[model samples]
Target: MKTCILTTDTYLNHDTGQGHPERANRVTVIIDHLKKLKSKDLIWKKPTKFDLEYLAFAHDKNYLDNVKDSFPKQGLNFLDGDTIVSPGSKEATRDAVGSILTAIDGVMKKDFNNAFCAVRPPGHHAEKQKAMGFCVYNNIAVGAYYLLEKYNLKKVAIIDFDVHHGNGTQDIFYDNEKVLYISTHQYPYYPGTGKNSEKGKYNNVLNIPLPAGTTSEEYLDAYEYVLKKLKEFKPEFILFSAGFDAHEDDPLAQLKLKSEDFYNLTKRTIRAAQLSSKGKVVSILEGGYDLNALKESAEMHVNALLEF
Candidate 1:
């Protein structure tokens, strides 16, 4: 089965103004690089429109409404200091969420073995009622809800590898026993929420908070905990908040992981999830500032996905 690459063109219009780190080029770099590969096993697809009601399952209805009203007719509007939206952001935001929903449907329908969503307005930092960290809609959180509500799946696991903790995703699933959220991130960092003590109510959240200078070896060792938890939970589906800022080549954070390490980490993850998820996986872009590291690491991650 081919691996699906889900994306859309509206991301180019998100327009975070001049010189924002989370600029449109982030996804553009990855998508352009992936397109260069001459692999026939890759299936490229655009995100399809989805229902607004499903967004409510992951965020407050009022919050969604406010977000809808917040889009500016022109220029940029800030949901918070860092999260910005422009005239095109309305469609860009929905398309980001829709990319993941479409990827999930493709995998579930067996149109592909697994998938990756290359989108922006990077989520996982946006909480149920608030947006932060350049993230607006907690895309993975919505996908987890889709698994439980639409597919009737009992267990779904979300693994986040962003250099920053996925505070928003944790907040959304903190009380939901049906989903397990795991993160490997830089502690004492931005958003400042992931800690060893911040386990979910059902003990479903596992956070492996590493220091600023954490090396490739150290990070991989810590990853064993995430795999162990996944094995114990035995999730019926898996979602990845794939962030490459952890790469040593990245500028956003201080972790020292390499590009190939992403390949190894992804390979190990899919292996561990084989029994539980039956190889059904969907990853979405999160954060990776250095364009070179972002492109190379995303390709390595996709290399692993293709291997399976």
Candidate 2:
């Protein structure tokens, strides 16, 4: 089966203002790079509208309402200290969530063996009632909840490899045994939440925190624990909070992962999914600065997905 690529033109409309790292160009660059591949097996599609009910699975009603009400008539409004929203941001943010839902539907229906969502305002840091870290909604968390509620899937795995920890995702699923959240990120970093001792109430959360200036070899070595945890959990579906900012070129953090490292990570993660979840995987964008590194790393990631 072909791999589905979920995106929307609305993403370009969610302007992050000048000098912000999470600019609209991130998704544009990824889309442009993917298009250049000219791969026949790629099935590109725009995201469809999703019911607000799906979003409620991960976010609070008041929070959603606040986000809806916060969109400025013109110019920009800040959702939090870091996240910003313009009038266009409402549609763009909804489209980001829609991209994940559409990707999930495609995978569950067997329309594709796997899918990749390249939407932006990346969603790993938005918690139940708070929007932060350039994230307005917890997109992947909602996708996982949708799978559990709609498909009755008993076990799901969320693997996050962003340079920064996915604290919001962990917060949403910390008590839910059905969803397993595993993350590898630079320690003492932004938001400062993922600690080795911060295992979830049900022990469903696994965090592998690497120190600053970690090398590619060290990062992969730590990733083995993630692979082992996923294997042990044996989930029915796999969700990836795929972030490429660990690349040495990224301005955000101090990890030194090379472009090829993303390919290896994808290969290993795919193999684990094959073993535990029949190759059912949905990868969503989280964080990645350095346009060249983001483009190259994303291409390598999709190349591995296509290989499967």
Candidate 3:
């Protein structure tokens, strides 16, 4: 089996205005870099149309209706202060969500060992009913639900290594005992929801909050806890809310992670979960601002996926 890369040109239409950290070029850099690999071990695919009911599994029906009506015909509409959508966002948002679903199906059916979804507006910030932090829909959360409902898997683990906390993911799975949501992020930072004490209602959520200027060694050291939790959960399938904003060059956050650290993080996590997950892994883009850093970090992340 090979590693699949899921993406679509619709992302180019999700304009966030004149200047925003979550821009189209983020995916462009990653796709361009991955194309340069030209490795037969890498499989490139586009997101397919999925049932809309899956979105309702992770979000409120009214919220879904609101989002469907929010797309503007000519200008951009704001879902929140930072989360905006343009006319093309109607298709782009659906594609972003669909990308994860397509990746999940590919991995589940053994069409691929794993997949990476290069998409935007990045998810993990959008809650069940509200959109925030440049996210309109919680893509990983939707994928988790897809596994639980469609495939009837009981234990699924979502490892979010983004620089900022995944408040929306935690919110959706806070009470669900079947899913374990773990996050490592900068503390006292944007969105401000990832405290160590903020465990889920069922104690299935683990939050490791690191302060700003955390070194690569420090971040990797803390990641041991993430592996420990994943080992304990023994998930049947693993999903990574892959975020590269922790890189030192990322302008949006203050973690000193080097590009290579992503490879270690991914390789170690897969090894820890291999026994139970059986190499069934899927990752979706969350956050990473700097183009150069995003490109480098995503490449390292994929390298581990390819070699695994």
Candidate 4:
């Protein structure tokens, strides 16, 4: 059982314009760094072509139609103040979604034990009808729906370790009992949504909102609660909204997690849910700004996936 790395070159075309933190180079650095490892334990793969109806699993019909129409014919178009699209964004966005679906199919079919999608135009912030926070479509949400609808999965869990809260993911699964969405993020920060009190309708959502300047020790300590919750839920499948911007080097937020923290937390999460999930997991790129930090952290994350 190997770990798969799913990605495509289409992400290079989803231009965000100049000086944007969520640039195409984010995935470039990660893919470049991972390739340097030359690890035989990794199975490199490209995202397979998938049905466009899968997008509707996460987004509204009108919203999806609007997004399809919003892609520019030549230059750039803004989906929101921060979420931008270009001529190539049409392919990039669909490829981003396709990457996850392909990864999910691989894992479910045992072609790989797990996967990490190094993709741009990161999802997790796009809500049911609105695109925000450098996200156009909720990729992981659609993956969860695919698990339920396509694979007939009954218990699915999403762990979001991004610096900013995944308000969009929480919004989509708020009332859905079969899917559990947990997020640990710097609160009262950008987007400002991950309060501990914002549990979902069926109490399926858990938000561990930490204050800025939280250190590696403090963040890991808080992560124990996440593990405890996972143990209680005993999910059948697990998905990670892997984000590394919490690294101290990241200019995005003030959380002080080191690169190795991702490995430790991921190892713990995999170990904690081993019995229920059978080591079945799929991770997708979300947010990580500092190139060096993102590179180091994503490598550490993959190391954990390779190990377990």
Candidate 3, residue 185: the lDDT equals 94
Candidate 2 per-residue C-alpha lDDT over 202-305 given as tens digits, one digit per residue, 9 for 90 to 100: 89999999999999999898899988888889999999999999999999999999999999999898797687699999999999999999999999888888
User: Per-prediction TM-score, please?
Assistant: 0.99, 0.99, 0.99, 0.99
- Residue-wise C-alpha lDDT for candidate 3, range 72-155, written one tens digit per residue: 999889998889999999999999999999999999999999999999988899999999999999999999999999999999
Backbone clashes in model 3, listed as residue pairs:
none
Candidate 1, after superposition: displacement of residue 172 in Å?
Answer: 0.2
Question: Mind giving the per-residue lDDT tens digits that candidate 4 earns over 1-308?
Answer: 59999998999999999999999999999999999999998989999999899889889999999999999899889888989999999999888999999999999999999999999889999999999999998999999999999999999999999999999999999999999999999988989898999999999999999999999999999999999999999999999999999999998899999999999999999999999999999999999999999999999999999997
Better of 2 and 3 by lDDT: 3
lDDT of 1 at 242: 98
- Which portions of model 3 show Cα errors greater than 4 Å? none
Write down the worst ten-residue block by lDDT for model 2: 269-278
Instruction: List clashing residue pairs in candidate 1.
Output: none
Local lDDT at 221 for model 4: 95
Query: What lDDT score goes with residue 97 in model 4?
Result: 91
